[model samples]
Target: MRMGKGKTKLMAAGMSLTVFAGLLAGCSGSNKEESSSSPKTSAASPSASGSSAASEQPSKIDTSKKVDLQFYMLGDAPKDLPLIQEEINKMALEDLNATVTFNFTTWTDWSQKYKLLLSSGQPIDLIFTADWTDYQSYAKKGAFLPLDELLPQAAPKLYEFVPKDMWDAVKIDQKIYTVPATWKEYVTEGIAYREDLRKKYNLPKPESIETLEQYLDGIRKNEPDLLPLADNQGYHTESIRQLTTKTVNSSNKVPYGLNIMYDAPRDVTSYWGSPQHLADLKMYKRWADKGYWPKNVLNIKDSGHDVFASGKAAALLGSENPNRFNDSVIKIKSLHPDWELGYFPYPNAKGFAQPVHPIHNGFAIPRSSKNPERALAFYEKLVTDKRYNWLTQYGIEGKNFEVEDGKYYKMIGDAQSNGFPREGMQGWAWRNPEFMLFEKSFDAVLQMFSDFDKIAKPDIFQGFPEDWTPYQAEKAAVEQVEKQYLYPLNVGLIDDVEGGLKLFMEKAKQAGLDKIQEEYKKQWIKYLDDSGIQ
Candidate 1:
């Protein structure tokens, strides 16, 4: 089974910020209108109970009237979701006089449903959001409400809990729209291969592209029943891109073809037309010929993780998101306890690693929210209150999981058999590192993150908001062209690399690629100028 849909393509980095203007502004704003509309107080304002590190502080904002909130999150709801939701609601009702309905947009149709939920003007109080989910574009389009006026008064603890730089990172034109997750993570791409197979073949550790190729070749020749590289559309291109780029450039999806040279962060170029891309295309063609992956990989609906765990694949290409990777490891161990798995981060090949963008995982209030203040209060509890955080993130302690010495998280039973595992509820939006737990088995994963932190560089392009509104037509046309030509080309399904490149470039130009690039450059230049970055 697939993990959460939040395991997105490896993302960009964060920028440095000096001040917490959003909090200051929210605190200084007039609250007379807000106070007048406050719900009438209940007869009894219950104090929060439990061993929560975040004690309930007396609030100036009234919570007199009861309210119901509709919150949306990605991925399928676990079988024990109702149980978790009931517990969460019980806490909310006692503390904030609110009840939240947890609505999950199952992975298969989450993208379509996420957009529809925002566009349909539903009374949604909070929804999970992130950079990969078009957060900048949606914020600019007025789909999310600016939280500067509500955070200080409604969610004071969260206001202070999230670092200043994070709030600054989520700002759209000087206004914050999302509450970014406080967790630090690296979303770098890597290969998860069968260590047993590698050892059986006596292959070297895959630290470089050449070594990785050798490993794949070994699998192709030795393991006749297993696919050399199991890859699905979601991660195949990204994995290959990481392998090809090395440390040369950092790319983002917002402006499609734009990229920043690592050595020259201010330099932007159309990556699709670059010589490097052509060389990468040739490499993919060679790999395809060697049967590294199935020719119909682009059409395969199964996730690479699924194929690998089913024991039909030798290697899985994916990101290094710890939670997802750990889950995959646990699942595979349950099925094939004797099969050893190994990981090789692609960035290590070039000694380059970048931490995930600050807004990589966050929550935003839709413009159609009926009770924004109450929603923030609930969210504050979810993020800052240890009881709420542990309950939502880890599920019911005895049944779903248990912690060892309050630091190591351990699943109670076979994770695959359990209805809820650690972080199964998509609680990523409110993850607080202070209360986060790690499994002892995750020592290698933690070591990977530690190693990455030593070489991490700041991504200059991430959080540089680009407004594509002016080039909507060009953006739409370019996306259509990419789907038709670039997708197949990236997967090496196109037979003639040179001819495919020529045709793809011709189609892209015809689709107004130049116009999109021009707008991107203009915005980038402006951002550099504003940030005082040369």
Candidate 2:
């Protein structure tokens, strides 16, 4: 989903947790390596013909008995919520013979807080990490201990539960470090518009970018006063980035994937970086100039849910998962009771990129966990152990939620429960799946995966290490300049092309594009040696 050091080898076959074991177990093989930017794969196997002391046995916790783990949560909640506080603690203590105390933080400041926590050498046991969140950065700092050393002792069931290879994918520097949440594939944002608006405009669902332009234009023609494409306060910049760059070109097979994670300084990444960039800048400026979207777009400070829900916006940008959600459908229904909004997208329009399952948020245990055995046992029970994973994952039965006529319904939160988010129950936790127990009311969302697979691509990218992040900084600087200056100039805000570009490049060079690139190539090569990539 993001960029990396180089090309990656796709897994030989789609694997289950068991099948992935062999790959992860012997991951430290001396085989000639590939790109320093290569993603970790399950290449190791389980202990083969091996015998060791019973203390080396990973399953049994040294139950001199009572244990407690300080779990640091990255997102917000009351210090407690949903009546599970006492219940979860009681269960952990009773079942695993362990107790967990949580420290709460908000998502807005989670990154800084987490970084400070880990770097401060705080004794945090386990945490929830995500690719799109903090996993890569922390792994690079060597913050979390390698699972190769800890798992066998602390997480035997987890070792067995997730198979070795999937865990291998979480490795960095040949050491298993992070565990990804198992999620159904097909996660990426795309165009979502009101079909009723399309009908009002006599437009067809867009199948290609070419058609998207036509559709946007059609919306404008039909509703001249309406900013045909309205972005939530949050999506304006994101929308701009997505439409202008090849960031969404998931077909690339380079180990770095789409390069969306860290936008390279060179405009095309491999091509003339600034030319087509200026072209796109002008293109959007044309939209702004022509008034296709709101002029106050840059000032939005909240979720686009309102614009999307208010019947004011014609289209909203979101991932396939969100679009298929029941809550989204419900929100659309309530906002414009008669409106029929539906998703209009192609997972891979050119149809070549591998349909790598998009994993956003998930969990990981820190090496600092004093009771690795109990920690992983807790994780295993949280995931595979239905009852425990359920309470920790959802909530205590019946109070915050309930099982209605077979479906899990909410009597506590809003709609489903009091103040509950009804967009859909099908959230993709790193470990949680929308099983029958969880998917009761969200039947339509279940088909979202199968429907997407028919269209998902085969070319995929791999995850890369952290040292490269700084190297990519120069390109990022250039992109920022491009976004700030070149784009606006192209829109005729400044008007001179060659002249404007020259000044922009000059200012950018002074801002250190060349030095940044030089540093990137130099450091990237060193990282190659460190990672043992050929």
> What TM-score does candidate 2 get on C-alpha atoms?
0.69
TM-score of each: 0.85, 0.69
Q: What lDDT, from 0 to 1, does candidate 1 have?
A: 0.72
- Each model's C-alpha lDDT? 0.72, 0.50
Candidate whose TM-score is highest = 1
- What is the C-alpha lDDT profile of model 1 across 419-510, one tens digit per residue? 78778887888765556665666666656766776676655556667688988888878888987898788778888888998898999999
Residues 177-241, candidate 2: write the lDDT tens digits.
66555443344445677788788768877655566667888888778766676553223334434
Name model 1 segments beyond 4 Å from true: 1-55, 59-64, 246-255, 309-311
Superposing all C-alpha atoms, what RMSD in Å does each candidate have to the true structure? 9.3, 9.1
Candidate 1 contains a number of clashing pairs equal to: 4
Give the C-alpha miss distance for residue 378 in model 1, angstroms.
Answer: 0.9
Candidate 2 RMSD to the correct structure: 9.1
User: What lDDT does candidate 1 reach at residue 15?
Assistant: 31
